[model samples]
Target: MSDNVYIAVHGGAGFHERKYEKEIKHALQRACNVALSNLGSKHSSALTMVEDAISSLEDDEHLNAGYGSNLTLDGTVECDAAIMSGKSGCFGSVGAVAGVKNPIRLARAVLDHSSIPSPIGRIPPLTLVSEGARQFALSQPSSAHLVSRESLVSPQAEERWRVWKCRFASSDPSSLSGNLNDIQDTVGAVAWHESDGMAAGVSSGGLLLKYPGRIGEAAVFGAGCWAQEASDVEQGMEMACSISGTGEYIIRAMLARRLGEAFEKGAGNSDGDDPHEVLHGVLNDQFWNMRRGRGEPDPSVGVLLLTRENDGRARLWCAFTTPTMAIAYVSSKNPKAKAIILRRPQNITLGDDKPCIYITGISL
Candidate 1:
């Protein structure tokens, strides 16, 4: 009812349970708000909002990105990120670039335009490749690779973090799935708005293992991120190139393309079957009903809903994995309810009688 578009975002679904102070929660939430508000104010472009949100989050050391990122099982930090724009049918991305504070912003820089400037071949981005080789060539203990090699010199204190030992079972066959550490710790964001179309971005600290090539869906075209004008496909919609990972890519694709279509239909009805309600309906019900073939369940997924309707209105909503799964053991677990926020947004409040279409009804 506030006419604010919808957007949703998340770091990772599979997280560890850790308690932080209210101030910490407020700090991160405020950070989220700042990113959203800044992008929303500047251009109102969905692409801009998602990309900048990622940039802001990546800048924060508390998050599992950029600086302070968890060392891969190989004792190094390798990052991946991507962004897609719906209206233009174009996107940009980057994979495994270290020393760069915010990998998502870099990916955003690539997505905002065309012809991502080719690197001079095998620079910092190739660190992952180099590290993985060292891990294997050295035959380093898998357990040693799982935790950071940083040495703490507090004479009276012990280490603060812990890594599992059995995590290195040779019998456990899943070669490429070597990233037992980072596979679950992830960050994903998508946004849609009025005056524009839809767009999304995903950034992750990849899983660790020997020979861990930079395989971020963010860098792969049309996998993790994608966009296209809902108003016209003939005009061609923009899409983010995503890497191969059936579950992750498909989920966002439907949210961007299909959800966009559903929102358009629901918004046209005078009864106020708004975008959120329509999206919720399709995801909670129809989408699953239509799911086909056998595929690994993508339980570690999150949403950022920010988009506008044909009537020139906007809204924001969010959903994520169950708390058991949403806990970012290595990162942060500050979230609302199971899928709803525990505290109401200070600046954002749903209008009365305008109902959420699911909880309440629309007005004339």
Candidate 2:
């Protein structure tokens, strides 16, 4: 296999200016760099690349995943995460798992250990929750036990939790408003490795002040993440997808799998239509429009796509419904990299002039 690799990441999907723009951009760039830098190493695969990528964002206090995850209504933090490999059709996820410093890492461990033998009569569960997941992690021969819940909570997170808890007691509905800009702040990554395999992973602290046991779209397979390995690359299509945004809406829309199916349908067309237009149309015309028409809260959505064509070049696409989507990308063909907070673009048609979903991407 060649050493070619590519990666992209988002801090979250909603209104997030908790830190200055420079700081946020730096975080995105740093995360992308961590993933892209491993492209040169022979040992790096798409699975490991994405795991490393999300770990960077999780460690940063500005993002809302591992160390800086949001608190539940009861002022406790419970995180959710999942990882899937396209080639093996294997997956692992953890939901409402607490006290772990990096949930994605635990998800990866589940994927790695799911098939291993336990004590004679025991069978390791593929997906784990709450205390079970934490205890499982400690039992494994991993480097360290799960971190204390206090060690994972940031000061900002603590303050936000306190305020929200007070509003909850007073029955103040005003504090429940979703910050559209920062709502898409959950992090994810999709990658295509030189070995001709695809993989994707997502991690998020559920919505602000959500119910204690809430498990968002991120922990659900084919909802927040999906990937399928190709048996014959020349004659068939291979796809991987990841979504960030309002978990409820994402679950309702079946965002990731639906998008992947559309790509598959595009491949069956003789004319070879680009999947980008199809993705944009679905989001603008079907998903976002329907939500707004129904008077539902339009939590912003961000999508990352990695697809492989028979020609051997990898196509990358990213789109978001928010005013701006923070992103960074790097590929072997282009070693130089940069991160940008891309603004949503509007298009004017003959009969209508409304904003269309903007997809900024590259083919490498």
Candidate 3:
């Protein structure tokens, strides 16, 4: 199969410049690189990026997500995640999975195997079954396997592993000791894998205090992530990207999605499928503040744009934020630059209209 282009994203949303220490920034960068490396070796599928990002969030204790996800009034870390495809429009999602690192990937698997995709015309797409889907998850390498819920006990290194398994494996929640209220964070990933082997994926993790009620877009399809024609997303009747930013972070990330929609509509349809050129127009486009929120200054979103091609093209774009600063990364056809790096957007524009990702119907 030809190596086609594919891209995915995980938006952290708003960030505070002073909040992230050098170590923190470096850690985030390393996670991005790890995500790509995992994908390249096929050790981790496109969906694995979702797990990679959330794992970092848990380790960092930032962005009100992952292990650090915000706490509810009662204090608990109930989480949610969603994954979708820009290609087949298939989506899968799960909410409140405790002890699981990559909720988004599981959701993507649901979409990949369970749902019946919308008809693509005279030709109809076959659907996947749950049994096969379960096998797919089991097939991953140890690094990609669903780490047992016991992995996060926060105990001495010698006994941490055994303790975690003991706590999480129990049939009764009562058996688990320390703070049963708050769990870890929620995670999700999106990707498009073609019959020819091209694919894309995205992920996000949020929530800290083990709060149960705070549900963000990452747990829902079309709201957080999307993709197309690559593999399984086409059935949803819409292809879109994933959302990793928090409530505030999500609102800010809108700017980037606005740009993507513009590209889809024709902001920069040059002679070829050069995504780099597409970014030139998408990132630079100017727009007014959109979707009024409770806060002033009208918020928006950022992006990490990626593109690739052997014969066909695949793109992965990630957007994230915190109170300190926003981060974006891109990966694509250029094998030399498989690593994800931060970018300074020269023209950060806000949209007055609410940030939205539109999924075209199969009929369209």
Candidate 4:
């Protein structure tokens, strides 16, 4: 086993309310602890840790992912999830899926299914959607993961949906403005293990009142999550990233994979190999600027990234354009997970030419 193993998770990049701060932090810390607890098992790897951690997050009703996800236009619960392995470059996802207790487990099953040799030379699917995804889940050995669609909906989510749906029908422009506390904050995780290198995964309940069958970045390859090793071992860094924000903009930019590429290419500007600069450059040039040019006044995104250098140093980085982002981290060296709700300072003025982005790094 590798001497160092680490896992980090994010609740989402959105306006996390001060009233629910304790519950949000506890949820993130619980996931970190659940992931790290498997360290004693001989079979544990980065992939499993990522899966385990996200499954825990999905079960929580407070965040928007699994059980307490947002409702569709017709008031049905649908979810999107994806997982990727840096070691093998394997990817799997499910989109607009319902009736699954844990969507991340289904995604991992898809990744595992892709490895089987096919006798008829038929290509396996990287993603499955709607009823097809549910059928595929039923075909898996653990059919117990499937549940009644209504059973997955929490009382709190149903109430939120009812209130929003009424407001939506009234044709109130304020409805379109959206409540900060009720935004679609997709949850995700990134991890690195001595033996398996790195892996990342993301899950989302999607936007409230969205049309049925709508898919978000969480279901798209290279958009929601990315994990990869450095091509040039001596000079480069192995990295994995999980992203949360507006799905359309994130999908167009392929934000997660873009960040991985930036790290692999080294800092191209005068910043001189600073990861912080690379993050700012990508968020500004690729995401923020592009969105603004297209007439988008506000674009939200939050990223949780894990990096390991050739010299055996590892760090966790969080960057977001939203008001606040909740995250937690734990490693073998420090078993106790630390959770924090990072809020952008209100005193910081946003300029017309500048993107409202905050970046911070934590040593693991």
Candidate whose TM-score is highest: 4
TM-score of candidate 2 against the unseen true structure: 0.87
The models' CA-based lDDT, in order, is: 0.43, 0.76, 0.39, 0.89
Q: Write the per-residue lDDT of candidate 4 for residues 1-364, one digit (tens) a residue.
A: 3447999999999998899899999999999988987776778899989999999999999999999998888999899999999999999999999999889989998988999989999898999999999999889884329889998788988988888888888978676565733477799999999888999999999998889999999999999999998767767778999999999899999998898888877733345257788889899999999999999988899999888878878899999999899999999998899999999888998679799999999999
What lDDT would candidate 1 get against the real structure? 0.43
Model 1 C-alpha lDDT per residue in residues 17-73, reported as the tens digit of each score = 345333223434543454455543546666666666666555554445554454544
The candidates, ranked best first by TM-score, are: 4, 2, 1, 3
lDDT of 2 by residue, 1-364 (tens): 2477777777755555635578788887888788877665667888888888888888987778888788887777788888888887778888998898889888888887866777786875668888888988887775124888878788988887787677778887676774422633788888878673888989998887888889888888778887775445555567777788888888888888777667666665643246577678667765786677777755468888787777776887787766666767777667665677776654434222343456876675
Alpha carbon lDDT at 186, candidate 4: 92
Error of 4 at 88 (Å): 0.6
Candidate 3 yields a Cα-based lDDT of 0.39
> How badly does each model clash, as a count of residue pairs?
55, 16, 92, 0
Work out candidate 1's RMSD over C-alphas.
Answer: 11.4
Candidate 3, superposed: residue stretches over 4 Å from native: 1-11, 17-19, 39-45, 48-64, 115-211, 230-240, 244-263, 267-290, 293-300, 303-364
Off by over 4 Å in 1: 1-8, 16-18, 21-24, 36-46, 113-162, 169-185, 188-198, 208-211, 232-298, 324-364
lDDT value, residue 116 of candidate 2: 72
